[model samples]
Target: MKKTNILKNGALGALVLSVTFGCASTQQEEPAAAPAAKKDTACQAELAAAEAARKKAASVGGEWRDTGKILKSAKKALAAGDVAECIKLANKARRQGEMGYAQALEQRDNDVNSYTVERGDNLWNISGKDSIYGDPYQWPLIYKANRSQIKDADLIYPGQDLSIDRAVTSAAVNAAVQHAKTRGAWALGVVEESDKAYLAR
Candidate 1:
């Protein structure tokens, strides 16, 4: 009877201690969170640097998707006094900006703005690819740049090498998009008059 009572008392004591420690740990973590989420002096500077890098990437037409979104969230975290979250998100945004700028630089310095035509590839679809211009309306830019290899804007053959002008100005891109949007109906295997006018420009 004594041994049984001692064992029962020990089990109860263990359960009580476990519950006590759990509560204590939660309380400690709660207080730590209050301090952890507080603002840091370097956080704003980090956000600024990230924004600058993102702008540089945009200048080179190399800004990746969702970078602005992440940077915006970092600002929200900063306003909410979530310094840790702001720093984490800011770091991620900064890396994206830096990598985007690097991608543009590499694409410019190296002749990486060329695409190999597939059997079913068309300029509209090829220009819409992420590695290319990512806009179907920019197909005229591809057709205009590859006039030597492409006789017709609407006709592209497999194994044909298409040159892409990655160093285009914002004005040129806008022009290409505008032209593609306003272009008339096309006859296959023949260059459209509208394409000739666009390429002339």
Candidate 2:
């Protein structure tokens, strides 16, 4: 009878040990799985955000090379199980995209003038007219403004619309005036000391 009791006790202890170990194993697996799931979810969210930003930037004609590179790096980090690095790269890409969109908006807003080309209107004549910048040498401004329509600076069709961003014209004129002054055009009678005196007559 004593031998039977000893065998029963030993069997009971073995069964209890197995059950405890099984529960412990299950607990460890659950925690591990939870973290992996969380990491996956985070990576997916970051990727989605990055893609959205890239699209927004592209819509505004933003430079996508750098942003694209960063996004690709983010994807690589995610694939490598570096969730933190992935998120960092994704955020950087998003900011770059936003900055590009903002720059586009600023440029668009600064484009304040639009004009239609008329017959016999070359870029030089149009740019030198009193209503325009009044400087024949500023023809490049008109060419650049109408780059989409005017492939060559020397060619422009009548009735073609063109953008005339005054900001660019003003900057060019200022730079020219500075250069003329530096070259002593004022003393040589090539240009006037004041920009008003140098206006096309």
TM-score for all predictions?
0.54, 0.58
Residue pairs whose backbone atoms clash in candidate 1: none
Q: Which TM-score value belongs to model 2?
A: 0.58
Which stretches in model 2 have alpha-carbon errors above 4 Å? 115-154, 157-161, 164-201
Compared with the true structure, what per-residue lDDT tens digits does model 2 show for residues 145-166? 5656665455678999888755
Per-residue lDDT tens digits for candidate 1, residues 19-108, read 999999998889776554445666887899899988888878777899999999999998987888998998898999899999988877
Measured with C-alpha atoms, the lDDT of residue 136 in candidate 1 is: 89
